[model samples]
Target: MSLPYTTWKIGEVEHKLRLTTRQAVAVEEKLGVNLLKVFMPRQDEDFPLPPLKVMLVVIHGALQKFEHGVTLDDVYDMHDDYVDAGGDQTSLLTDVIIPLFENSGFMPRQKETTDDQATLTTVK
Candidate 1:
């Protein structure tokens, strides 16, 4: 079966990011951290941001399926150019990382509810 993936544009090139079971295992082994925990939600205000190296490694792993011959250095360079073009970490998180995992079936997609639905829930 084909794994789900999402597309991210760095500069003029569009790269496909996918996280297969094998690739996810590889990434976890390389980082020595369970990806499920790494991607977990936290409530603490002081919760630490994911390390830059971890982000790069995940990005590299995701890129391996479609971006043959790509390396960690290449991902770093793309990230540098992305920052130079005014992309920030927040944007990267929302645009690339979140969607990458969500679309890859690693994270659950948040459901949207209307005001009436919210009111019904509150009134229950």
Candidate 2:
């Protein structure tokens, strides 16, 4: 499997997106938590979910790296439009980005099914 690409449309243009290592670091630093931990929580514990604002910022930061022509202001404007349209931003993170992280191996160990019992598979 590979990193999933999300389609981010700005006006009439659609950009295929994935977060880079640098972008991940920026998101982590800004949020003060491990992004993977939050997205891929262990079965034994729960990680704090990022607030809506932080989620938006992290995604915007990631987009800035992948989509060169997109500006921070543009991202915020798009976000506002999304909200105005009654779209939930949290879904944008969970439904879209989290799956991409899981496939891209950005997530840590997650539960796996074994014939005898459940096991953990570490994603590299």
Candidate 3:
């Protein structure tokens, strides 16, 4: 199932988001496949450590975006996957994943707290 918009909350803060105009057009052009990330510029990552942690955060954020929500158990499951894969648990989530999402038009809502998750009702 897919939601046009997905509301993500952090503590008392909430983020209401939908695909941006550009993103919408891109999605339409792709015919429904999520724009995937193939390469990352952060080659400086501690290969033996950082990539795994970063991958976890990316997965977590992806679940939130696509699934519209996720529970602690979900995070735990991801964390387990990381551990099982022999990844380091000390990597920085923001440093690892946020840049890519931001560059791709996925961003946290400006207000960070609003029960409003609506897609672009009208494309620009």
Give each model's whole-structure lDDT.
0.81, 0.64, 0.44
Residue clash pairs of candidate 1: none
Candidate 2 regions off by >4 Å?
Answer: 1-4, 9-13, 40-49, 108-124
Candidate 2: tens digits of C-alpha lDDT, residues 80-99: 77667665766667665665
Clashing pairs in 3: 14-112, 14-113
The TM-score that candidate 1 achieves is 0.77
User: Which sequence of candidate numbers ranks them by lDDT, best first?
Assistant: 1, 2, 3
Indicate the residue-level lDDT of 16 in model 1. Answer: 92
- Runs of candidate 3 with Cα error greater than 4 angstroms are 1-62, 90-95, 104-124
Q: What are the models' TM-scores?
A: 0.77, 0.60, 0.29
Q: lDDT by residue for model 1 over 1-124, one digit each (tens)?
A: 2336777776777889988788889999999888867755578736446777788798899998888679899999988988887887767777888888887778886567889999999999
Residue 71 in candidate 3, Cα distance off native in Å: 1.7
Give the alpha carbon lDDT tens digit for every residue of 39-77 in model 3.
323466533333453344444444444455765466666
Which candidate tops TM-score?
Answer: 1
